[model samples]
Target: MRALSPPVGLPMLAESDLVRQVARRLSDAIVQGRLAPGAKVAEAAVARELGISRAPVREAARLLESQGLLRACPRRGFFVRALSAADVDELYDLRLCVERHAAVAASRRLTAEARAALRRQLGLMRELAHRDDPARIVEADYQFHRLICETAGNSRLLRLFDGLASELRLVIGLIGRLYDDPHEIARTHEPVLEAIEAGRPERIVAHVDHHIGVAWREVARLARTLSPTPGGAA
Candidate 1:
């Protein structure tokens, strides 16, 4: 199977590491739309809800702020940052560059075991899609793409792709209901897998670029629709 880059220099932080645990939970809430775009995030409220002190919660907010998932206002509390259409376009463009390289490289170097693992991820995605759980489906979709990066055998490429995971989750959360069939989501990925399995680098690159391009357009459309007009209600 394709190997993930072993996390480097990460000191052991057990589950009891309250700050990180709190941060992860908050991040999940944001990525799953439990916290909506522009919704105020109060440190005290979150701390009260989670049965913790405010310090860790405040630290967690700062962590998310660094990731562009939260924004701090001067007088008000932190809020979920609204990703604009331009933001979506930039994210997709960067993703396209990284994934195209990974797909093309994986086509040339993918092993049989890695192919099997990739197929397994795709199967999991199909199952998640059928269950109609957007959060799980989005995660599965990310895992499948991550496997492709792993198959590329480039540690730097995998690291770059991993960096985008949080923002990608934000995009998926924004889109909400991805497709009517949901199965269509799983099925659409097949051609990419097929191309990679065929060991055709050009085919893999073309398919990846096209796939991401379509997703970019859809997100951009949704962003424009949701964006407030000059005189419109936000």
Candidate 2:
């Protein structure tokens, strides 16, 4: 059982908050691969389809633009930003640093209640698997990792990875990989979780670092495939 972090609260939105609502919807779509890599975004069409004005949609596009999810084109609309090998490497490297430390710190604080909470998340993921819904599987995996981060008791670490997680979703999709392959991810995680629950901090770190290696290679592969040869970055 590990100590998991409590759920984060939503920040207060202004009285007039259409822009944020639009932004959040688009962000969720992008993260889930509903708006996948290299897809063109028609602002007017998205606005029409979503039944909102273009102003909010445009603002939403811009929000993702700064986050490296969308790229603006002159005299054209936005397109999903492709990840370069360098970009993927950088993203995963940061993930490794943050997750490694978080895993170690969290392992030291494992509690019985936390273990049950994680098992619940895993069961939910298994249930989502019955439908073969990749997106749901990915979302569940995100929550599962969030559970690990929560146990680390580091707010800043979770916040840092939160941003990375969205882009990482795109990376996973690019590789035609789901965030959690039930058996594979389970194998990788079970060892770490077991080690953590058993209070073997050293073995816990070993299992975690080993599991992260797969992600590192996947990102490296994606970075190379997304390089300037096909279509350069925007």
lDDT of each model, Cα atoms only? 0.81, 0.71
Candidate 1 is scored at a TM of: 0.86
Question: Once superposed on the true structure, which residue ranges of model 2 sit more than 4 Å away at CA?
Answer: 1-17, 32-34, 172-187, 226-234
Instruction: Find the 10 residues in a row with the least total lDDT in model 1.
Output: 225-234
Put down candidate 2 lDDT per residue, 1-234, tens digits, no spaces. Answer: 999986554532441277778776776676665775667778899899889779778887888787778888777778878776777778878877887788888877778888898788877766766666666666776777788899888898889878776676566444336344554544455666777677776787777787777777876775565433222254
CA displacement after TM-score superposition, residue 52 of candidate 2 (Å): 1.7
RMSD of each: 7.3, 8.4
Residue pairs with clashing backbones, model 2: 1-111, 2-110, 3-151, 5-150, 84-223, 85-223
RMSD of 2: 8.4
Candidate 1 stretches greater than 4 Å from native:
1-16, 228-234
Estimate TM-scores for all models.
0.86, 0.80
lDDT (10s digit) by residue, model 1, range 56-131: 7888888888877888877776787777888898899899999999998988788889999999989997888778
Per-model clash counts, in order, read 0, 6
